[model samples]
Target: MAKIAFILLCHKDPDAVINQAQSLTAVGDCMSIHFDARAPRAQFDTIRDALKTNPNVTFATRRVKCGWGEWSLVQATLHALHAAVAQFPDATHFYMLSGDCMAIKPAQYVHDFLDRRDVDHIESFDYLTSDWIKTGWREERLVYRHWFNERTQKKRFYAMFELQKRLGLTRAIPGDITVMIGSQWWCLRRQTVESILEFRKQRPDVMRFFRTTWIPDETFFQTLVRHLVPERDIDSRTLTFLMFTDYGMPVTFHNDHYDLLLSQDFLFARKISAEAHDLRRRLGVLYACEGARFRISNEGRSLFTFLTGKGRTGHRFAPRFWETESTLGRERDLLIVLCRKWHVARRLVDCIRTSTGLPCIGYLFNDESCALPDLGGIQDSMDKRHRHRRALLRMLYEHYDSDRLLICLDPSNLDLIEDFCRDRSVTRLLEIDCDFSDRDLIEHAMRVGLAGDGTPPETLARLLPTIRNDMALETDTLRDRNFAHHSRLREADPPARNARAIAAFLDCSEPIAGALATTDQLFAE
Candidate 1:
């Protein structure tokens, strides 16, 4: 049987890392770990000692003192990959993973899957065109030289980043290279892995360029693969399942997420915490019982409808939201704006903010547009993206003060508004609905390249019906809203539309002049 190599990167959870490594070793896979150099000596020794007896296990000699959004993260991964390739020359495929990741498939099945496939299981997309570019920051990552180090005073660093951004100081992307970004975890063929190492040795300039780039791990290998070996088939989806909150923070996987995990076709699931003993135990039992089939349980079958909306024009699975209470005890009025069309919702957010004189923050669930403010923070890894989002959410909730608040979020994240209110003891739930047919949303999505791969029509044919069903289900859930599409809400004139929607939802006696002015100006332009 062909052997596989596992490159495991870890920082905080040594025990979980060891347990995961031991589990993988059962199938006789070679393992190499790159513990963060910033981690304490005691933690490192504990992990080292736990796996010391395992002859197949190796450690990266040059551990990196990793920092978020710095070159160190990529360097650490490179160190591990190099060490693994050197020690396990016979290994056929190498799987890059984190300490928190756990296998959902049997070792034999995973081995078979890798052995049979010639394609590299890596997610890669043109950074310029990807829908998640959020605020042209993707362009800035490559175009600007990030000067502020993450270890210093963050407030000052962010101020500096903004100052630089305002100054329009940007560098041109290298003529020879096209930047690509995607999920960091990947399973690469040994040859592909070796090629990357060789390329890195030959091209120090490219490596240096990426060193200052934000979240380069998401792009470095992916960009190199596309440039060096375009002929090599690449699968754009990762096998690891990670659940995120409305704010883009990773939701901790607990017992409730078990069925959710089983519903996916992924071989592994990430972000399993050390505290999830029951879930870990159940996972072990699942692998032992089912081997590689990865069948959904009878109970989980019932959840399938919930997981993937069915029987609707556009079915929408219930998007998960993490519930956290705000510390503020004072009750504030909330203007909840929910819609499937993000662009429309975004406009509505601006209208509501102007109308209510409250700042609006959109929690995007779908990949609609990439224009977002470039958040100034260094991420040590791609996994930290959610952490940054969570921090952003906390900061906004804690710092922003107003009598009224306008929140623009994807329809999928509507439940979060309820959680937010409940935490703040707000009794009134004012819901504003944006009206658009499933067809309209689908058409817009297809136009924006959100539907799927290929040409609009082809991708539409492939993805529209499913998305339509999802939207229909979502619409149904929000059917009881104060305002809705194809209802009395649509009767208003175009110039007074947003004002009417707000008036109708909030039951206000008078229209806010700001909203009317914005609507008039928007229509005029």
Candidate 2:
């Protein structure tokens, strides 16, 4: 079995660091941890004692006095990486992680993904040509030599850096090297790490140059890897997820972000705040459940099940609908209705909002006539297509306040919805039923100006049944598990029926239900 050397950088938040380390016990035998030397000794001792029993864990003997934007941060990571390589020389890969980051997927899943691949997973982009610099992000970090007091005048120095950029008096950018900047999170092959260490030894000038640059940690490894690794072998996508807020800081993951986080295909997620103990505990529990799924091994059979649940039959499918209705009844302003039919979804959204006076937003998949561009290619595997779709939706969902938002995505994306609902206490999921026959629906869709222009008739003939079958399978599974809170509304159902369903889901009073009924009747006329 191939092993991974985890290089974990931590500062404060000892419990979160320790919890992250404990979760990796199943996948790897070794970890190298380095805490900021500037942190209090008491905290360091607490972390040391917590992991003392783990014989495979090693602490960096020469920890750097790390400071943000200083070379010390890079030095601390290097020290940990060196320690990790020395302790676990045979480990095939090195994963750079932080105390705030936790594995969102099963440890085994991450391990398998890395072990099967020879390519290095490092996120990088050319600084000058990248949209980031064009969009005015981190532009002055490299072009200006910034100096600041670690304690007092950090913001003052930042202002000076901006002033220099505005005046176009920026210092000379090194012409010898192509500057690559991106997220610091990376997973490198052992040979790649060794190559980096060799480069550091031979090119002290580059190190000296980067040492004076602001936020060198983000650009240093990325730039070096670009020069060392072949372009084809470098997969410039990090497996770690970081949600950046509008304020230019990472948004801390909380309980509400649970569903959104699971929707991502990334292995790790970061910025779980120290104050959120419940969220941390919930993450631990969720990780354990995901880890169990990965531990099941029956050669090709388990792999099939892992990816598509091919051989996993015989398990009873039961959805616990209405299980969280009472809890949801306390306070929930959003009702998500997901259906493929836009006209039906629009009506459902209107009914919910008019009946309950609650804010509702609905996202309908593109109608057949207006199919999505072949962004993922026609031959892309189902899994890859699903991942691409989920990533796009995850970005969209970020705009909504998860607390105040009721999300209703189309049923075509139910796999994503089911995964999202796993960690969330949604008030209710309204599955809208489509009643038209395939031939009749296509004819109606064409007449209604919703038919796809690009999709051939034969393709639509095949695609519609597949979509219907998938929705049916998903409905059956969700209904079995979430029967209590799960309710269905037929497209041809009476307007009163729609009103009652909407009112019931929103947990509104009898008066609101009557109002919805009246509104539905008025709309029908």
RMSD of each: 16.7, 17.2
Task: Write one digit per residue (lDDT tens) for candidate 1, span 290-319.
Answer: 344544322222223333444433432333
Q: For each candidate, what is the lDDT? A: 0.65, 0.66
> Which candidate gets the maximum TM-score versus the true structure?
1
Decoy 2 TM-score against native: 0.56
Question: Per-residue alpha-carbon lDDT of model 2 for 1-525, expressed as tens digits?
Answer: 557778899888787778877777544547899999888999989989999998678888687787777888888889898888888878888888888877766656677777777888988899877775435546567767666634457688768777877888776666677889888899998999999989999998888778878778779999999988898889998888875543576767776555445445577888877776777777666655644432211122121122243224343233334322222222333356666566666665676566544545555233333223344352134444343543433333344433444555666454456544543335466776676578655654444333433334443464466445655775676666663456666657775786677567667776676565454433221
TM per prediction: 0.57, 0.56
Off by over 4 Å in 1: 150-156, 159-169, 284-292, 296-525
Give the 10-residue window scoring lowest on summed lDDT in candidate 1: 483-492
Model 2 poorest ten-residue lDDT run? 295-304
Q: Which regions of candidate 2 are displaced past 4 Å?
A: 133-139, 149-151, 155-171, 256-259, 285-525
